[model samples]
Structures are given as C-alpha cells and as structure tokens.
Target: MKKRLVAVAFAASVASSFACAQTPVMFSSINLNAPHDNVVHGVRLAVLHGKVSEVKGVDFSLIGMSESDRTTGANFSIAFGANKINKEMTGVSLGWFNWNTGKATGANLGLANITHDVNGLNWSAVNYSTGTTVADVGLVSLSNKSTVQVGIFNKTKHIDAVQVGLVNCADNGFFKCFPIVNFPK
Candidate 1:
C-alpha cells in the first residue's frame, strides 16, 4: 500500500521532531552561569547567577541569584539579589530575597519573603509562610494559616483574618497572645 503509506509518514515526522526538541522556546536569555534552557518564552537576563527550568516572561537578576522551576511572569532581583521559585509562582517577586518552594500566586516584594503556599501579597522585612497565607506585611510575620497579618511581630497556627501587631500570636486565636490587635472572636 505504497510502502505502508511511506512508513506512516516517516513515523509522523520523527514524532513531531522529537516533540519539538524537548521544550525549546527562547525569545531572550542572557545568563552568565548555570545551564539555561529548560523553557523560557521571553526575556531572562541574569548577570551573576541564573538557573532555569521554566519562565514565561521577564526575569531579571543583577547582582546575583535567580533560580526557577516554574514562574509565569515577573521576577526582578537587583543588588544583593535573590529570587527562587522552585515549582510555582504565578507572578511578581521583586527581591533582596524571595523564595518559594511551591505555590505562590502573586506579589512578594522582599527584604526576605519565603513561601510554601501563599495566594497573594507578602511585603517583607521577613515574612514566612509554610502553607496558606493570603496577606502578610511584615517586620516578622509567620504563618500556617493567616489570612491577614500586618506585623511588628505576628505568628499563627490559625487565624482566619486579621492581626495587626506589636505582638500577636494565634495558636487558634481568641487570645493565645495579643497586644495590639488580633481577631477571630
């Protein structure tokens, strides 16, 4: 049958060119270090340090450090720089230090912002989230489930929303520790 339809169209064109040569998309990438190219859709400029697995658009690192596994858009690091997203960061991380190990939806402006899970907003002078944090504006804010925490010092085990602090801790709230403001009463 015509040499089996030309060997099934040359085996579907060599399996679509080996799946398009395994994720090769680059619009711009200027890296000075570590293996660049697992995926980049556009714009990645890392001067001192760079590591990549995926970046959709715009990742700029100046003085040093920018790492990624998955980042959709916007990651800027400058002067004593650091930005690391190792699995998921949807957008926005401006840094003097910002880290994510998985699941960060948007906005982490940093002097140290760390995350495991954050839906949005962590403006930092040290804000840490080990799972579930919606907002933390910090001078030290830590979370396990904190919906809102504006801090001079705030800690949580579970606070559905609100802790404006001089010192506020919720080990299930209703005052496990409170000074300025703590909610869930």
Candidate 2:
C-alpha cells in the first residue's frame, strides 16, 4: 500500500511539472486580476500584395500600403489618437479616412475629415520630398508615398498598389491633398 501511494504521488508530480514546462501560466490572461486594466492596447495589420475591402474601426491610427504586390479599398477610422497612414501603390487603388472623437479637447493633431488619393502619388515623402501638409487635414496623393499625420479618416472604396501613400488617384480629377482643418492661432 505504501509503495503504491509513493508511485502515484511521483507520477502526479511529474505530470504537473511536464504541464508547467509545456505552458507558461503568466502568458495567459487568467493570471491578470483585471484583464482590461492590465493589457497592451493597439491595432495593427500588414499585407503584401493583398486585397483589402471595407475596414472600419477606432484606433490610435492606421497605415496601409502596397508592398511589392497590390492592395485595394481599405477604409478605417482613428478614434481618438495620432494617425499616420502611408501606402505604396503600383496596380491597385486605395481609399480611407480618419476621425478624432475624444471629449477632452486641446490636442488637435487628429482627424476632422477629408479624402485621400484623389490622384496617384505626386512625390516620395519617406525618402525625397520636402512637402508638408496639414496634420489634421485630409490628403490624397499618388506620390511615391504619403506620411499623413492624423487620428482618423474614413474611406469610400478599396484600392490596390505597390508602395502607395494615400490613394492612387492618377485618374481621379479633383480628389487631391485637401486640408481638413486649419492650424492653431
């Protein structure tokens, strides 16, 4: 009887040890007292030569572009924070917008509203352009890329491209870089 009990206890300990080695208890949210209070928050998505239809949400900000492939209609929102969107386009079209919706005012480096890429790229902001647009405004460019600084902007359609900044409106007639709001006084 004593021998049997010892064997069972040893087996149980080994099984528990094996389970611990296979999985980390802290890695799961079960260990957290308050799941919402203790958590890293943000939104992110990356696609290379992929198709993006309708996307809408509230985030600090969002950025998408064509890799060495293509992308399509990618519409989303930047609820209440900083928004930086850029995309490299080649054979696809892009469309999107952002909006800043916070009760506490003062920080205005966010979205109000506007359309991007009414025409294709006009310059490369990441590598060679010295052009600067309103951070809180809506801008559209087919330039090599666009480095828009805002909190949000909604889109109307999906687009495609390779390394696109804003939309590839090399075709659209008047949807250019239009400012959404004026700077501070």
Candidate 3:
C-alpha cells in the first residue's frame, strides 16, 4: 500500500509538469480570468473582443482582432474596428479594412487594404502596397514594385509585368506614364 501510494504521487507530479509546459487554450472574455500572454499556441476565441501579442493557430474575434507582434494563422473580425497587424500576416483577412504594417503573404478583401510589403492579391476599392510583388486590383491601385495590376487607375514606381486600366502609370518605364496598358523593361 505504501509503495503504491508513492508511485501514484510521482505519476501525478510528472503529468502536471507536462501540462504546464504546453500553453493553454484560451477563451477570452471581457469578464473572465484567462491567459493574457503575448503568445498563444492553440485556438482562441475573443468574444466581443480582445488582443494578443502573437497567435500561432486560429483566432476569432467579434469586433476586432489586433496582433501586436505577429499572426501565423487565420483571424476574423465581424466589424472592422481596429484590425491591425504589426509584424507579419500569413493568412486570410476579411474585414472592411485590412491593415498590415509589416510583410503580408495572403489575400485581403475589403473596402480598403494597406500593407508595407505584400506577396499576394489585394482586392478592394483602394489598394496600396509600398512593396508589392504580385498583384493589386481595385478602383485605385498603387504600389512601388508591382508585377501586375488591373484597375481603373494603376500607379507604380516599377513594373516587371503589365498594368491594364483606364489610366496606368509606370513611373520608371519608357513612357513614364500611359493610358489603357503599361509595361516596364
């Protein structure tokens, strides 16, 4: 009996230590006491809102989702209140406005889309990328290095592909600016 009790206690202690090693799954509320770390490794549901430092898995928010550092999975916010990504975004962002302060590697569909560096499509009424390497489609598309753009008015500092719109401007191309179609050497 004594030996059996000691074995059980030792097993419990080892199990508890392993549990603490793994980051807990968080369910955030404005009223509950939950994990408030900068990093989350599992799923998170923020009812009516919350913020985090970094997320590695799925995250859902009612009003808004703000990542102070980086996000490597999907994030959705019902209302586009303040959806800001400071470092990097590698998934889909669906909102009224999607703002990526750092590198973006996914699609952004909204009324307005802005990013510092992008490698995917930006489909919106107004799309702006400081460093674009893929495509931007909008009423007004602007980028510093765009590969292709289809819009009403397209502007870029350099183009390695083509632009199809009413007014296309390739600042460093042969024509400097053109209408209908434009390309760069």
Candidate 4:
C-alpha cells in the first residue's frame, strides 16, 4: 500500500510539473488583424497585423505590421509593411521599415533599418544603429561604432575599420570629415 502511494505521488508531481510549464508551442498560427499566442514554434501568418511575444520560426505579415518581443527565425513584412522586433532578433528581418530595439544578429534589409546593436549586416536606404554595427551598407548609415560603412553618407562616433562613402565623418578617425574614405588613426 505504501509503494502504491509513493508511485501515485511521483506521477502526480511529474504531471504537475508539465502543467505548470508556461511556454506554449503552436505549429501554426493565423492572425487576421489581431494578436496571436505568446510563443509560436512554427509559422505565424498575419493578414493585416500581428503582435506576439516570441516566435521561433517564420513570422510573415502581408500588407501590414508585424511586432514581436523576440524572434529566432525569419521575420518578414511584405508589400511595404513594417517589422518591429522589440527585444532581440537572431535571424533575418525584411520589410519596409525594420526596427529592432535590443539587438539584431543577422541581416536587416529594408528601406529603413534601425537597431540598437547589429552583428551582421544592415542593408537599407537608411541604416541607423545606436550601439554598434559590424557592417552598414545604405545610402545613409549612422552608428556609434561601425566596422565597415559603405554608403553615400556615413557618420559614426568611432570606427575601427573603414568608411567608404561620398561623405564620411568619424569623430575618432584620422580625419574628422573626409570626402571618400575615412579610417581610424
């Protein structure tokens, strides 16, 4: 009788642990102008707009806005839409306006790309990074620390690599403002 009671208690404890797990996973979510689940493991489709807490796979928004707290895979906003990752993005972000508040570790391609920290590439008409960027290729690129800046206008407080643009300005470079290329002293 005591053995059976112990077995039941162990099973109950295991079951309660599974029940208390808060991270919900979904295979697919279709959001039509509304918010979906907090966590999605698979594809998330939004017809007009979508708001979520986290996404592991693809998050696509057609003709509207896509907002998420964290994204691991591709985040796309089609037809001149906007993609906003509030916390961190580990993969590519493609849209008209790609905005990442925390950190972006992959490629950000859009008309205007803004991020706090970028580790890979920022390709847009206007690329702006508040913290640092490995590379920024756009018509206008602005960052605190850019390793490589290739654009028409490149401005940064500190650059460790090179800036190749029509007009380049670096505060800590050999030249404060150069016409074609600028590098650190």
Candidate 5:
C-alpha cells in the first residue's frame, strides 16, 4: 500500500514538473510482459496525455515468443514490453473479446501488474453459441480487489499453460458458462 502511494506520488511529482507544453519521455529499456520466446525488444516511447504511447523498434526477438498460441491463425493479441499493461498508462490492462461459434479460441499472454509487479496473463475462448454474452473485456489489474469478467469464453476445449488464460464456455447464445482459469500455484 505504501508503495502504490509512493508510485502515485512520484508520478504526480514527475508530471507536475513537466512544462505546460507537451514533452517527450525516453525509456532505454522496459520489461513488458510477453511470451518468453516472443518477447519484444527495443521499446520506443511517445508523448501523449492519457493515451497509448508507442515504444520504438519493438518486435519479437525470436519465434520462441510465439510458442504460446496452441492453435494459430490471425488472432488479436498485443506484444508489450515485459513491464507492460495499459497503453494509456491507466494502471490497468488492455482487454479484448472475439467470439467465434465454430471452433474454440483462447487468450494467452504475459502480464504484469505495475502496482504489485504481479506478472501473469492467461486465457482461452473456444467456439461460439447462439446468444453467449461476453464480459470482462476491459482494463483491469490482477491485484484488483474486486473481480470482473474478461469476456473470454470457450465452447468445449479446456486448456492449460505456463502463461495462458482460458475462456470459451458452453453457451445458449444468451448466457454461457466459462471454465475455471487457474494461475500459477
């Protein structure tokens, strides 16, 4: 708790010191939570107020980084520095939702909570149903005291991994039941 207060105080101090005009912040290196083999190196920093900034020369160093996507295709996932989360710097994570009724799909990524340095992200969404509703797809911190659904659901496929989260549950188009998502014990 003291650390968070300290961080917020530091940020406020730093932000206050900035000129009324916009200024650029430089980051030599940052650890964005991403797949180990698919880790993106060389992050670039951009200037923005309450917006997602860019980190320069960032890309996956090796194919090992992408080893987490068990079944692959064109899916939407982001590669942030190991210290990443919330492009807007909102102290939360970037959330998403994509429901396909035919085949099961899942979400997988490396996550880190800046407040607690809690690094973890894992999820899977498989299959689609008639009226399955999606929720919990928004900015959230793992150390958050309350729980909100991330909307990642599955059809029938159950999955596990070192750094993966699963979602995709049985659905009747209106409501659906998601499976249990367990983190490292």
Candidate 6:
C-alpha cells in the first residue's frame, strides 16, 4: 500500500515537471484566487487582477488590469481597461475605455471605443473605426464606411447608408455635408 502511494506521487511529480517545461505554461496565479492561464475556457473573475492569452468564456474584472490576445466571449472591466484582440472579437466588451486593435464582429459599449475593423454596433460617447462598420451610435462617431451613424456629429468617407445627427459629413456623396441627416446616392 505504501509502495503504491509512493509510486503515484512520483508519477505526479514527473508529469508536473514536464508540464512546467512546456514553452507556454498555463496555470492559476500564485495568489490562489487569481488565474493567469494561457487559455481561459470558463468564466473568470478577476477581483484584483488576472490575465489570459485567449478567452473563450466570460471574463469579469474589477479594475482588471490585464490584456488578452483574443476573446470570443464577454470581456467586462469596471474602471478603465483595454485588450488587444489582434485576431478577432466575436463577443461584447464593456468598459470605461475600450480598444479593440483587431477585427470586431460584436458590440462595444463604453465611454470611448476604437477599433480597426468594426462589423457590429459601437455605442459610446465617442467611437472611431478605421474600417467599415455596421452601426455607430455615440456623441461623436467617425468611420470609413459606417452603415448607420446616430450621434451629434458623424463623419465618414463612404456612407452607403444613413447618418442622423446634428452635423453629418459624407466626403464623397451627393449630400457631401448636410445638417440633421445625410445619405449617399
């Protein structure tokens, strides 16, 4: 019986050693509750802090001061935090200031939001996207090809859609600059 126990312990140690030797080791943080895994496949709560390489589930952070390579589920931050989803973002992200440096196919709600390629809704006080976006609703919205914009001031280069705001500017459209509403023909 004792021999069996010893053997099991030895095997466990050997396996752990091999796991640690891996290039990208994923494990919980030293502070028991916090986790710093290579990939988060479940809901994670960061009371003080936490981080992950990729998130496949919900991530709620309280003053979450960390970054993620990519996120498929929701990413929420209390104070002001950001992530660089270089690959893609397919879920909702809520924070005071949100920044998605990759392609986004979901929604972003915050005080300020920015993305490279936005294919979904962006609702904030100020929103900016380099690529075409489906919708932008904020106080000031700007995009290259925003399908719809509802804000105080809206600006876009190609508006194959509509803009409803105080001042709308479609750089290359029939109604290049209009008041209240603008559209391209």
- Best candidate according to lDDT: 4
Residue-level lDDT tens digits of model 6 in 88-167: 78999888767787888899898888887888899999998888889999999999888899999999998878999999
Name every residue pair that clashes in candidate 3: none
Per-candidate TM vs. native?
Answer: 0.39, 0.18, 0.77, 0.80, 0.20, 0.76
Ranked by TM-score, the better of candidates 2 and 6 is: 6
Worst 10 residues of 3 by lDDT: 29-38
Which parts of model 4 have CA positions greater than 4 angstroms off? 1-36
Model 5 ranges with Cα > 4 A deviation = 1-24, 30-80, 84-135, 138-147, 150-185
TM-score (C-alpha, index-matched) for candidate 3: 0.77
What TM-score, to 2 decimals, does candidate 2 have? 0.18
lDDT string for model 4 (113-173, tens) is 9899998999999998999999999999999899999999999999999999999999998
Instruction: Estimate the TM-score for candidate 6.
Output: 0.76
Candidate 1 vs 4: which has more TM-score: 4
Q: Model 6's lDDT to the true fold?
A: 0.76
The stretch of ten residues in a row with the least summed lDDT in candidate 5 is 61-70
Ranking by TM-score: 4, 3, 6, 1, 5, 2
Query: What C-alpha lDDT do the candidate models reach, one value each?
Result: 0.82, 0.25, 0.76, 0.85, 0.27, 0.76
lDDT string for model 5 (42-142, tens) is: 33221111112332232221211211111222222233222222211111222232222222223323231122111222232321223212222322312
Per-candidate total of colliding backbone pairs: 0, 46, 0, 0, 46, 0
* Model 5 / residue 87 / CA error / Å: 17
Candidate 6 wrong stretches, greater than 4 Å: 1-36, 46-51
Model 4 poorest 10 in a row by lDDT:
27-36
Over the stretch 1-185, how does candidate 3's per-residue lDDT look in tens digits?
Answer: 99999999999998897578544477665554266565677776666555667778776665655443687777666655435678888887666677888888888777888877877888889988877658899999998898898999999999889999998999876577788898985
lDDT of 1 by residue, 1-185 (tens): 99999999999998797567633333223453333356766677666667877888888877877788899989988688788898898989999999998998989998999898888899989998899988899899998898899989999899897899899998888898898988776
lDDT of 2 at 125: 19
Best by TM-score: 4
Report the C-alpha displacement of residue 53, candidate 3, in angstroms.
2.2
Q: Model 2 — which ten-residue stretch has the worst lDDT? A: 99-108
